[model samples]
Target: MLFGTSGIRGLYGKEVTAKLAAKVGNAMGGAGRKVILCSDTRQTSPILAGALAAGAMQSGAEVIDLGVGPTPLLAYATFVEKCDGAMITASHNPPEYNGIKLFSKGGEYSKAQEKKVEEAVSSDLKKAPWDKAGQKGRKDFSEDYIKFLIARVDSQAIGKRKIRVLIDAGNAAAYSIAPRLFEAAGCSVVRVNCDKPGQFTRNLEPKPSTLSESAALVVKEKCDFGIAFDGDGDRAIAIDEKGVVLPLDTQLAVFCSHMLSRDHNKKFVTTVEASLSVRETVERHGGRLFITPVGSLHVADEVKRQSAAFGGEPCGEYVFPFATPCAEGLLSAIMVAEIFAQRGPLSGASRGIKAHHMARTKYKCRADMKGEIMRKISEKPQLEGRLSTVDGLRYDFEDGWLLIRPSGTEPAIRLTAEAKSEKKLSEIVQRAGNLIMKEIESAH
Candidate 1:
């Protein structure tokens, strides 16, 4: 029943199932009059989507099925249609897992609201009268979503440049959007792992270690840039024209620099896990930075609350308020490409920016033990240096910081560290992970 940091994600058949999905749908629908339904390429998603739609109908709320596509398309449809939206996706989780993410009418959900949806499902609310049952409808908005993005950026400028780009879909929902978007931008695109839904050919997270294929393709194709998207197509990771994998934090810094330089009044939002370099980059361009807790929902909520120009995590999920309040990999790819087109070489574009080393390590732990471990860590006197429990336990020191948070979709504790040196950051993360695991073992 834990909603984790983002939504309710779990292994298929064991944790996530049709009945549970239906219950969640009924809960959301009972609370609202209209709902939008969407799903990703996972095998179990369509079945869950059907159950969700049925439950919504039973609750007397009309269901608009957005069909299979990226999570961002669903969010955009929800925002434009003014309806509560639910996307059935585990989002970067392995093939055995799936989940559901809910958004409010404007494609944003507050923490309080997320908790309410969790509560509604747990409470088993009543369904609407049989005679007043809601109906289900179908919608195809992929092309529309692509066009919406095309209109926002300088497509003409991008098209005029002869850019070679490599795109890795990671066998997720981006397969439905990435190639088309890049082609529209006039780039010679080489696609890797672009396949039908449910065919995941690589690790779904899009992290550097899992992106060797994409990097290889970028180099082999001699592309100017390479982009990779997670399962739900909400987050992205990038490789420079030289085929060097750019860490998520560095990518965020680059994107922030581009936005801040062009739009000086823009305000950017990032999580506590973001690198100090991101704040510095934004400030250098006369823009302000707002740091929120980790999680895309939190980022999106803060974006809506503060009316910020953009929001992203160091993990590569970014939301442009002007485009859509949800993270869109296709949008990020296009934006990054446009930046490279304007700035010449990717390396030159990244020059003159202060840099920091960032690393993340995760430890396997029982979900039930997270609270106890966090409580124990909070009470340890040795760990009281510049600590903030805003979203889990975040310890911020003078030169760097570390964040220990529970994985919302997995049975693991994620430790993220950022400092000036890779060796130092890795050591910090290992030390923290070791300490937390020791605590968890002792609790048992």
Candidate 2:
């Protein structure tokens, strides 16, 4: 009940509540010294964070609250303070939802650890004595986190390009960091909807429909490119200078190309849902690509397993183990700038990446019925293509692929189809979507 692919997330005051937060925190059962605690700008973040801290305190763990900021800051703080951390953020979820993202030993808690916590959440455990109760404090690591970010990039090299950039923080978590990260990297940064609070002015998801205005601004201002972040700043979607939203696969392929050129490591890791372009780019560049089940934790775990130097998802989450294990969207934008500086324009890097016609659609399916629906789908007649059930059913062909997976974080079935031709891609999506809907109906 307390954990999912990422963490314990749900609609605030509903599936997620102060009571559940405390229970889960107690179940986490670690007296992590100098535990770093943080939250996003969601109205319920503070109350949830407080409940989480209280739970940890009961376990004799001190809490160091890092106020409001993106999740990556909390990740970075864990490294600096050599402590565990927790960020109360529902990430890209809608404003009414919130979550708890736990950090341990420098990265997210492992699935095994999460299972233990889940078990604890179900059963009560001993609490600390009154005299041994944990302590609570506060820290302002925003400045240090920014300083750390500035030191990681070649500011001089980035400044040489004099690149102008547009940022749409979505009135979410990155509002405070995106601008600073770019400006510090010597890029002229323009921002929109970075200040409104208590409500997200736009949809929290960084999709083309949601970022249309930001994309238009890039073209209007003649900015080199635009970067948009989700509610928690972990997912980043890019818009090109021509006002076209850069497809997630294209971003992954371009960045993977950059990492491949460095010769540091010939290894890249990505989610199975990633576009075929990313896989081909990595292979063609002499880098071995490892595919993991969807989820940032799964990607991070695979990266560690394979000692991959770089990892990312098609959805714009990048994991550079050099900085921290968690995905960092703001840093990804800076990395894009550095890539542009060295590679001239993103078009140059993207030119080698072939674009595919892709369609993504979602159908509402209750959480309880998702499993049976998938089972029905698996039992349906086979297609004339290779099928992979690693994370979901992915039918692969030479020119395209289709992936149908239940959303781990939402009550919906996600359908993704891609092909070299638009008409074929649409047919694939439509056919698969109809089949799933039928199964969902049959289950009912």
Scored by lDDT, the top model is 2
Model 1 alpha-carbon drift over 4 Å, by segment: 30-32, 422-427
RMSD of each: 2.1, 1.8
Q: Give candidate 2 misplaced runs (Cα > 4 Å).
A: 29-32
Flag clash pairs in model 1: none
**TM-scores, all models, native as reference:** 0.94, 0.95
Q: List pairs with backbone clashes in candidate 2.
A: none
Worst lDDT run of 10 residues, candidate 2, spans: 25-34
Model 2: how far is 367 from its true place, Å?
A: 0.7
| Location of the lowest summed lDDT over 10 successive residues in candidate 1 | 104-113
Over 1-444, each residue of candidate 1 has an lDDT whose tens digit, in order, gives 557776888888888889888888888886348889988888888899999989888888899998888888888888788878899999888878998888875455666877777788778556787778889988887787889988878788788887888889877887867888888778888988886667887888887789987888788888988888888888878888777788777788888888776674578899988888888888777788888888877788788888888889988888887877777777888898789878776777777667788777787888788777878877776553487878888988777888888876678878888887777777777778778888878877
